[model samples]
Target: MPSRFTDEREITGVADLTPVQRDQLRAAGKLYDGEDLDAAARLVDDPDDERSFLGFCNLWRVVDGSEDRYDAWLYQVDSGTIFRAGTTDVAAEIIQFGLETRDPAVRAELGPALVEAGLLPKSDVSYPEFAGLLRTQQGA
Candidate 1:
């Protein structure tokens, strides 16, 4: 089972997108909106229920070519959180935690965009470091 964080997948960022890419992404999987995730999260009756988790993305990247590619939402397999009597805030927290938790591996793969979005540390470290490291530097 290949995950969205799959290392071998080819990626084309937003700038290079085309109509064909849109078609390919659609074919890959339905791009669940934030609202959709929110609704689904609310329906999470059991902590182990996986179907309640849906894929959501504001960012777009075309992976591989329509010729052959994997599901854009393979992240769903690695992501999602369950309700805790619905927890502190069912709608907001589920989506927040789920997205945050699943993103590290993928966010590191994001370079300028993650930096621009302020989700990553703006520093001299490369993308992998931005995603993987804890920055602690001192001036002596």
Candidate 2:
């Protein structure tokens, strides 16, 4: 069988995959179609996974041309969840949020989150600061 994640490495065999995996694949497929009920359900079961999935969902929204909603939802995502997803955009957003308010914890948390989420190659994002780029892009 084909690998579900892009890395193409086995986290577990399909037969051994948790119900979480099966639902994730389905929700990922449904995200753009606006059928996020299952995805939302999965999130309730596991906020950690849901947070990561939401980041991917947000990315999908952006890539699929739902920019306005994406920007709006960006603020709603929990810091812990963003870190869990570890997306570069999520990291950048966190960095930007911290920069605006001068919060060290945001930057500190984002770094390890990026590493855990595989968004960054290393834990070096520990103190990464976002420029005004994201703000400008968001028209904030």
Candidate with best TM-score: 2
Where is the poorest 10-residue window by lDDT in model 2? 1-10
User: Candidate 2: where is the Cα deviation over 4 Å?
Assistant: 1-56, 59-101, 122-140
Could you give candidate 2's per-residue lDDT for residues 33-123 as a string of tens digits? 3454543343333546533343322221211132211111122232112211212122224322221224465444333333333443323
TM-score of 2: 0.22
User: Lowest summed lDDT over 10 consecutive residues: which window, candidate 1?
Assistant: 84-93
Global lDDT of each candidate? 0.30, 0.30
lDDT, candidate 1, 7-89, per-residue tens? 22323233343444333334233333333333324234555755343233222221322322222222243322211111221
Model 1: residues with Cα > 4 Å off, grouped in runs: 1-48, 55-59, 62-109, 121-140
In order of appearance, the predictions have TM-scores of 0.21, 0.22
Q: Tell me the RMSD of model 1 versus the true structure.
A: 14.5
